[model samples]
Target: MHIPDGFLTTPVWATLDAIAIPAVAWTARRAQSELESPDDRRIPLLGVMGAFVFAAQMINFPVGLGTSGHLVGGTLLAITLGPAAAVVVMTAILILQALIFQDGGLVVLGANVLNMAVVGVLAGYLPYRLAGRGKARSAAIFLGGFCSVAASASLALAELLVSGVPMARQLLWFSAGLFLVSGVIEGAITAAATRAIEGMNPLWIREARPARPVTIAVAVLGAAGLLAAGIAVASSAPDALQALLPGSKNAGIPEGRLTKIVLGLAAMILLYAACVIAGRRIARQRSA
Candidate 1:
């Protein structure tokens, strides 16, 4: 639910921007602390998880009523990385989506970031932190995914309403129902994905064991395939926010569909390279 420019009032976006800036800075420090470790594995783990979240957000499925839903990946990141690190990954994804794709708007970037990256990740992580290690771990994870999307979507809807997006009360309730359906789907996807990851490397999440290079490669490659397939299969349905703006979607994604796809691919490559470089730097610093 990336809020584009001109959708929000100046006050709404400005207030969120003010709150998001210091909040992100604080989270960055916390992420650094989470990454500070002798294991070295934690370094690459950060970027890999970021890529996972990035790719996950790309593939949207139809959820009916001229709207679509996609995996938000907040809880998954929180489960794999700590809440602080997850926030950092999500923040980077949102920023890149805004810049490279104009998938979101610059002026309102902070509002989107706060909704999806900060509160979304934290809201999802709360349940897991409470009951993840016990037998209720499965339920906790599902709820995490549910809460992640629910919280972000709820905030987006509320903000849009507050900013005078002009939805009838019925439409508002309809949007809420759509969001709830999406949240349930997200919960299921998250739980299944987490289970698959744990099956492959249980210690990766809990103990920070190094993920095999091959596993990461396969996952990234799979995501790439999905991205390609998504372009074809992804519904043309407007998302909840876009639905309100009627006839306002410009050129698939502000620069033609092909251009957006190419940039997305290129951005993924840059993310991988940046991660490798940063991971090496962190590793060296810790070693010395």
Candidate 2:
């Protein structure tokens, strides 16, 4: 779940950010080293895989309790691409959110990135990596997806506790429940997607390397567009945000819903164009 502004206290957010910045930079460097030679053929595939994940996340998984969460795709990506490289791609997605849509606060950027990208990638990849091939790999993917969500939620709750947010005990339970539901959905999605990829392109598991910059850029754009679009769709529906704000009318639909939907479509188009162009270039390169 993308946390909105003002939920976390300034001090707590700031502290989490401080702890997250250097950690992100370090992860980026590690990813670079892990990246295969620039000429490696797997880059294009990885780029496309990232874009596929981005698009997949747009379709929200139905979680009960009137709450739905989008696919985290951390474990799925790690299963397809290596964990270190997945961190790089996931961090890019988070940065896009903080900068473009304002879905998350700039003050909490580092912490958010760490919680969503670093922790998620590691949680998903480590288990699968530890497990050998075959059924173990599948189990790792499921566990990784669940653990990633749990870790991020736990981290968010920890931040709340540190910030002296009122009702830490209550908040902890809420966070646990919310993330547990989200994690189960994510695990199922990850498992199905991973199984499909395994069936269609088992070779993807071996090609965990860096790809062309243009392709990477396009895929990153796609992921960001999909996330924004998903949020826009959610915004159109009944918003818990509005309910939280007292004095807000629960009467008919909100005035801004149409605008959000239109913007989402436009964003989706832009990202599709970018990905198509990048895909073309990649195709040409492959043929050459």
Candidate 3:
């Protein structure tokens, strides 16, 4: 659930933007350290996973209530790329999606990054970390996928609600139901994919690491900002929220079927190339 720019108040989006900047920096640093295992395969795998997730997010399914959902791919990335690297990949994906495709909002890019990249990936990786190499590996994979979508959707909903976006109680219920179904489907897809990958090469799944306090702290800070934003929005005038929501109202994709398809494919290629180059740089650094 990519929260378009108009969906959040100024304070909420700005606060998330503030949090996401440093969080992303920290994850990039962590990613470098985490990939220090000298495995060249992991480098190319990073590009592949990023491209796969980027492609997967483009094909949305109707989730009702005039909204749609996609595979998201945060869980799968975390499982394969390691959480920190997953965060880096997702940040790239979101940035490209916002900047080039206009599939999301530049003004609220930080909020979307916080929701899906940071919180979603970590939440998904939590179960795997807890059940490392245990008999419940399959269950953990499913749970990771479930938590990834649920956490992201819930945060997006809260952002909208706290932004004073009027929603019927029934509509909220419908959203919860839709996300629940989406979560289950995500879980199944992730599990099946993991099974197939393991059948071919278990090493593709990043060996789970112990949970880190700093990682948890980053997530907690993001959530806490969300909570504070919600409180502020709850107490503010609806008119105030409406006024703040229109930051860069003219910012949207141009309408044309052929142009979009061409642009989309071009963007995907550029993103893949960028990720591959970054992966190589990181690999070279680690090797050095």
**How many clashing residue pairs, candidate 3?**
0
State the lDDT of candidate 2 residue by residue for 1-288, as single tens digits: 566567777765676578668767876676667757755465566567667767887987666778777787888777667766787778777777778868777777766776788777776664454442443556667777888787777665545444445453345457667788778888878888777777887886643222446434535543553354255323633243343334556555355766546655686678767755654554444335
Which whole-number lDDT from 0 to 100 does residue 281 have in model 3?
A: 47
Clashing pairs in 3: none
TM-score of each: 0.67, 0.63, 0.71
Among all windows of 10 consecutive residues in model 2, the one with the lowest summed lDDT is 236-245
Error of 3 at 229 (Å): 6.7
**Candidate order, TM-score descending:** 3, 1, 2
The top-ranked prediction according to lDDT is 3
Please give the clash total of every predicted structure, in order.
Answer: 0, 1, 0
lDDT of each: 0.72, 0.64, 0.73
Clashing pairs in 1: none
Report the alpha-carbon TM-score of model 2 versus the true structure. 0.63
lDDT (Cα, tens digit) per residue for candidate 3, span 1-288: 777778888887888899889999988877777776766556676777788887876777665688766677888888887888899998988888888878779999988998899889987887676554556678888998998898888888777777777876557668878888889878877887788888999888888654445544544554455445444543543333334335423557564444444554565556645744553443344334
Q: lDDT for model 2, please.
A: 0.64
Estimate the Cα RMSD of every predicted model relative to the unseen true structure.
Answer: 18.0, 18.2, 15.7
Of 1 and 3, the candidate ranking higher by TM-score: 3
Error of 3 at 83 (Å): 0.2
How much is 226 displaced in model 3, in angstroms?
7.0
